[model samples]
Target: MISRTLETTLNALALYAIAAVLGVAFFDQLVNGELPCPLCLLQRAGFLLLAIGPVLAVARGPRAAWYGVTILAGLAGAGFATRQILLHIAPGDAGYGAPFLGLHFYTWAFVVFVVAIAASALMLILRQPDGEATDEVQAGAASGDALGRIGILLVILMAAANVLSTTLECGFATCPDDPVTYQLLTPSGS
Candidate 1:
């Protein structure tokens, strides 16, 4: 039987984990000069979507509906990552972007999404019966603790960065299938 406070704390931790993944992806993009492919963008979007439930759970007391959102988003993200993996599975084909820790980002994304789904399911199964929130949970939710607030802010910042980067990379045009440069940053004649 998980207390509301514990549940909220877990949700905040999940947000932190998601933000870490996004942070690494953003760092790789900027530092490594690796432009994300369309599939990679979709995978990132999936991760952002996965954060929605945790954000809501932290802001409001834990709810089954919120976890459901996380599960659905994780499934979508896993699918996108799988698609990218399969695309490069052919013999002699080099995968997109550089491999990190011997596995491509897409493969890592798939792993993260799966783990999130499993964790959300376990959380749902262990949640307190009748959606009851203890006094502590209610107070925490109302006041918003520092750790949870910081986690939420981090995810929000990462999401904003992703939006700005994607807009610069693709502009108003469709993202190039194999993006090598930022569309909006490059001269039209060049």
Candidate 2:
């Protein structure tokens, strides 16, 4: 029974939530000096792509197309996280990167990806009214202007943060495949 405006707002909030989670991870990396591995970077890419869904939903109202974008991005992120998890399946293995609260970043990334998929699916379901198509699809996006603005702002901030962190981590070039330390800080670019 949710209205399109409400649904759009919810999607915006969900996107912001995902951005916040990634922000926390970035902070953790900065604090602990933990350079992200290849899989971790891939997961970050997935998250960034998934975040676009909310902005689109807000800009155009609730549409299955936007949710589809989220779902696909989530699946890609989940795959990356799962691959990283499998790398350390053996007992007594030190695992990649630093662990947050005893769980690695990739593990958290997996959880976030699964949540994204679920949220996108739910939004898609709620977008339909009484199990039929409705005019909400063509409704004015201006109704969700406030939420849309916030979503767009969050996207900008997230992009800037990622750019800063990535630059600091890898400098003006590509990051190493399995970086154990920040490339910019390492002597002779080891």
Candidate 3:
């Protein structure tokens, strides 16, 4: 069922997003030469997972590995988003936690997290297994749910990486020591 062109499209988007994050990391670590703070590293990890999640889903099918990755990626996104909110919303605390408070990166990541979880959940719930009906949702769904799943995952991963980095490396929303940089070159260590 996933072998169709539509599935290929989703896989492409997921792969592209994953590759972009890797590219950014390469630039930061290799080309630009930067180090990742704790939070930044976490975010980069989340993006890697995000990129891998949907393709895995596509490969194994919704009820199989896809569901597992969907849940995992969603949870990771939620955790990252929640952490940023807590740090940014800390009442009197003004330190490394609130790094992205003024910047919209925190806000954007939170939104993406929620959206990704929602989309993954919706896609999983709405999608029928290979043995069942696949045409029902496509004919009924008009929101591009089928087409947008990968895109949504990509967005979530991108935000998770950047915002997570911001929360970790920056102090009071400012860059800090050993700050991580990002690039878009390739796979090998640069």
Candidate 4:
């Protein structure tokens, strides 16, 4: 019972964190008119992928597979963020995108991914299995609960918002190498 609860809470926390950050990014783009670069878009995709694990955890209860998803997504995002950081390592190179609270968005993304990995690892290590019958019952019951519903809703909303924004920014193809503005929105051949 305790393990299940802990896993559920951790999953909820992860989902909420991802949503909050995405919300901030959305507002920053909508209100500030700052367009995300291609790498930033990739990092956003990573965050969306990372959220899948937590959403699964909430909907299906604690499972190793869900945690595995989080770990893999986190590592991928971290790698991309690290590469971007290295690109700006030279003196006065001005990192890609705007900095938030003294750190670039990619830096924050790297930190979030690392933290997700750590949290998922801890959950995996600390999980104590209930009997199969009890687990099945709990998972089924939990799936219909309020938190699970909220998790599903958030995932849908975030995914929809991301798809819309990406479409507006990149249209039906790949984004530019260093997108400072919306490509699809611009006049043809500009």
lDDT of predicted model 1 = 0.90
By TM-score: ranked, best first:
1, 4, 2, 3
lDDT of each: 0.90, 0.76, 0.52, 0.80
TM-score of 2: 0.84
Ranked by lDDT, the better of candidates 3 and 4 is 4
Please list all clashing residue pairs in model 2, or write none if there are none. Answer: none
Best candidate (score: TM-score)? 1
* TM-score of model number 3: 0.51
Give TM-scores for every candidate, taking all chains together and pairing residue i with residue i. Answer: 0.94, 0.84, 0.51, 0.89
- Estimate candidate 3's alpha-carbon lDDT, on a 0 to 1 scale: 0.52
Candidate 3 lDDT at 114 equals 62
Candidate numbers, best lDDT first, in rank order: 1, 4, 2, 3
Model 3 over residues 41-152: C-alpha lDDT tens digits? 5655665566566655443433435546756875786687567557657677553422333743434455655665676666555555554655434422322445445555
Clashing pairs in 1: none
Please give the clash total of every predicted structure, in order. 0, 0, 10, 0
Residue pairs in collision within model 3: 23-183, 23-184, 24-182, 24-183, 27-183, 28-181, 28-182, 40-165, 57-66, 99-173
Deviation (Å) of 151 in candidate 4: 2.2
